[model samples]
Target: MHEVSICEALLDQLTSLAAQQGWPRLRRVWVRLGLLSGVVPDALEFAFAAMATGTPAEGAELLLENEPGHFDCAVCGELELERMDFTCPQCGGALQLLRAGRDLWLSGVEPMPS
Candidate 1:
């Protein structure tokens, strides 16, 4: 799955950051996931566990924060919180997804001395 690749990328980034900062070990990893990011939390977690094998982040916890999807209505000038459909209820206009929930960001990393 793509989540495995994503996890690999994250590990790479973490390794680079740790090397750059001269950290001893990684403690935790904070990630922000969007509702429409097309990523399953369970799958990501599984991938993390599998990919972290024999790595610095083997014992690190992956903390995920989920963000909802939102859209803007052009006709009513209203911001709509969308879960499924992206149709404006007020003006019946097509809603534009202002914030596409497809972000995979490494928010923070905690390191501890070995």
Candidate 2:
């Protein structure tokens, strides 16, 4: 799966950040996973665990925070959709996507105790 590649990139970023910030070991990695990002959480976690071997991030907990898809309706202002639906419930107007839930980013990190 592409999650492996994603994890590789994530690890690269983590490595750079750790060196820049002088973190010896990482304890936790926090990520924001959008609902429609097409990346499976389980797959990502598995990839991370597999790829993190012998690295500073080994044994690090990968925490995911889900971000819901958001839309803007002419009549409803804003709406949060759990699934794909382009119609506004209130006025049946066409909903415009404000956030497509395609965001994937590292939000925070926790380092091991010195």
Candidate 3:
């Protein structure tokens, strides 16, 4: 649902970047998908595939990197935990959620050389 909008926004950004950088074709897009960003990877990929037809990103590869959430346990200082895993194994303490996993962002873009 919202992934479509998100993909559309990504495409818009890619287009703008290509124009600004004078790149003719988009070769690859590297995206970091945060663990708790509430975005479905499959849906995002599907949206990209469907929307990229006849666009500059026609043959681009969408590389998705899963970014895990971070938590701060009073006893453990800081810890990296995957989605829904909020318990500290070291000291059996509940972790306070951090801001490491709440964004879906474009990390980098590789363009085809002219």
lDDT of 1 by residue, 5-83 (tens): 8898989988889888888678899998876777778999999988887777888899987765677787777474636
Residue-level lDDT tens digits of model 2 in 1-114? 779888998999999999899998899999988877788899999999999887789999999888778899988799887667789878999998887767589999999989
Q: What is the lDDT for 62 in model 1?
A: 93
Clashing pairs for predicted structure model 1, backbone only: none
User: Across residues 1-114, which tens digit of lDDT does each residue of candidate 3 receive?
Assistant: 989999999999888888898888899999998887888889999999899887778789999998877789998798886676667878988888876767789999999877
lDDT of 2 at 77: 94
lDDT of each: 0.80, 0.88, 0.86
* Regions more than 4 Å wrong, model 1: 73-96
Model 2, C-alpha of 29: deviation from truth (Å):
0.5
What are the clash counts of all predictions, listed in order?
0, 0, 0
Candidate 3: residue 69 Cα off by (Å): 2.1
Ranking by TM-score: 3, 2, 1
Model 2 earns a TM-score of: 0.80
